[model samples]
Target chain A: MDKKRIEIKNEADIVLARQAGRKMAQSLGFGPADQTRLATAISELTRNVIQYAQQGIFEICDQSNRKAIIIRVMVEDFGPGIADLDKAMEYGFSTSQSLGVGLPAAKKLVHKFSIKSKPGHTKVTMVMTRKRV
Target chain B: MKIPILQLKNLLLTSIQVELTDRDAIDFQYDVVHKVAETGAEGLVIDITAMDVVDSFIARALNETARMARLVGAEVVICGMQPTVALTLVEMGRELIDVESALNLDHGFEKAQRLISAKKRMPG
Candidate 1:
């Protein structure tokens, strides 16, 4: 499979990330519900890159087993890292005027979630699995 | 670039049948607020069953539209969020707590009716 990846530096980049993620999810046999979940998660993360860091890379990879294929998304940005990762993950916590549902809510959209950050770097990863059906 | 807004009785309905860009969402918000004023509609229902996803920007615009509608004495109901879209929005931390939403268009119409009646009963 061709590695699904895109650079997110603007509103258009965020759209591309969602489309690429959706295509990868579709190829991995993800159901429409799961596909939408992955795409929305990608949208949320790429939006963070544009809103916070101003630029970033969004990459999609696949891991497979005999019965299932896992689609993984990674978003990395060199923006202002979260001062409090834990706080950021809490629902209803926004440093901006937003509804504060971006980071913490994205965690629930996938089977797995992880984030790491320091002053100029932030990285988030999410994964969903599609069992052959 | 104008998203159609339909007026029925005392209610207004808008169904976004196309993929929306940031510009679309922005223009939609602007249009919705003004339409509510122009029509003096008491209820607004936004049907999004055809939409599979709403990004953060769109989410914000929707929330703003809801608030603006309320400010103009109109109650807004968002209806027909697909199961997947609902799940994703909740997971994304956008519960849209401030806006009233329904499971489908029919339910949305019911909710709009209720909200309008409730407002009429409110002491001014």
Candidate 2:
């Protein structure tokens, strides 16, 4: 259960964090498509961090057992958290006026997804599992 | 010479082959619209097939560039988005409304041609 943490403070760090996620996925035997998924998800969360809070922390942890290789991710920020978590998770309810599809889309790409937020804190966690063939 | 947009025969083509830093994305938006002005191209095809990720920043840049291209009288068509990138964009709430997309580069050309022709026929 080793975890690698990244601090996202600006736009450039989002790129760096994605690169790190890609390398980790490769080393963990994630296929190109899944690597893209994980990396893209990281981008979504980290970009949210930079835009909303201006800074946040992300962690990627390996949680494999005898069955499958599991990649767990946690993204937390101290920015103003989502006021309406339900609306945020809805596919088209976007306050920022982008497509408003990010959170729901990320949920669809992973094995597990969860989120918690308040006035000054927001945390999102996702788990991606790959079969060890 | 690190040109962000390439022009050939009345169409502006840009392939995002690598992960673009935010600065690059912003500069790309600037150059693409101005390039439309310089070349007077009737169409634009942005191939993001080689790009593995299209985060919100990149998405905004692409969407803005599309709007700007339209403002300059050039039709824009996006092509070569991998399945994963498309899905990611969906989840990021970046539907990129108003941007036309095609399955691949070949189809993108066809779509752009149709759009260009349609624009020509419209009363200006």
Candidate 3:
């Protein structure tokens, strides 16, 4: 696993983090669709950081093989975290005026996605692979 | 809700004044793009200044609107993006380049007029 990490503090950092992750995933030969998915997933997570946490850390690891590249991203933030994980995961549940599709959309964009959050901190992990489904 | 079609000289401006929420993002994209194409406008300016926040979906829709507009010889300019809204959009890595932006409706109209004039100057 080739691991790279970055900390996101502002909205600008989120853009950089997502671009970095997408570039790394592409360099490792992830398919275009997967690359776009990874980019979108990272975008969603980083948007959360800016909107909710105001700061977060993003980590990307690459797992390469003959079949495809497996990319994993982890975003962590310390802020007023989620009180109800289930409710937050719902499609139309938004604390802000947003469509509340960030988490759900991110989950759909990746092969696997998970979230762990408390009152003061939240962590989201998403994984994407080039292996054909 | 119906999308209002505003004709301005050679350009056609369509206003979809729906809530810029995630649930409406896809519909907004479809309606706006369809109307822009149907009107055969030389350029399109999406006025989202009425919206408070633009999420990933809306941002994506803007990008798509630009792409779709371009396909029909029309350019799309997104105007009235709030600072915070712009920040969120930038963080989301959505491409706004395809759609030119203005600070407000007046500014967008000015830019659009200039662009239309520029196109007119160019030989077909």
Best by DockQ: 1
What is the docking quality class of candidate 3? incorrect
Per DockQ, what order, best first? 1, 2, 3
Candidate 2 RMSD computed on C-alpha atoms after optimal superposition onto the true structure: 2.8
List all candidate RMSDs to the true structure: 2.5, 2.8, 12.7
DockQ of each: 0.58, 0.51, 0.08
Q: Relative to the unseen true structure, what is the C-alpha lDDT of residue A95 in candidate 3, on a scale of 0 to 100?
A: 93
Which residue pairs does candidate 2 place in steric collision? A99-B93, A100-B93, A101-B91, A101-B93, A102-B91, A102-B92, A102-B93, A105-B91
TM-score of chain B of 3: 0.78
lDDT of 2 by residue, B1-124 (tens): 2446777787888888877877778788888888998889999999988888876557778889999999998999999998877766664554543489999989998899999999889896
Better of 2 and 3 by DockQ: 2
Interface RMSD of each: 1.9, 2.9, 10.5
Q: Give the poorly placed runs of model 1, Cα more than 4 Å off.
A: A131-133, B55-57, B91-94, B122-124
Which window of 10 residues has the lowest lDDT sum in candidate 1 chain A? A1-10
Compare candidates 1 and 2 on lDDT and give the better one.
1
lDDT of 3 by residue, B1-124 (tens): 4556577876666555654433355666677667667777777777876654454655657777778777777766778866655654454443533468889777787787788678879997
Lowest summed lDDT window (length 10), candidate 3 chain B: B88-97
* Residue A27 displacement in candidate 2 (angstroms): 2.4
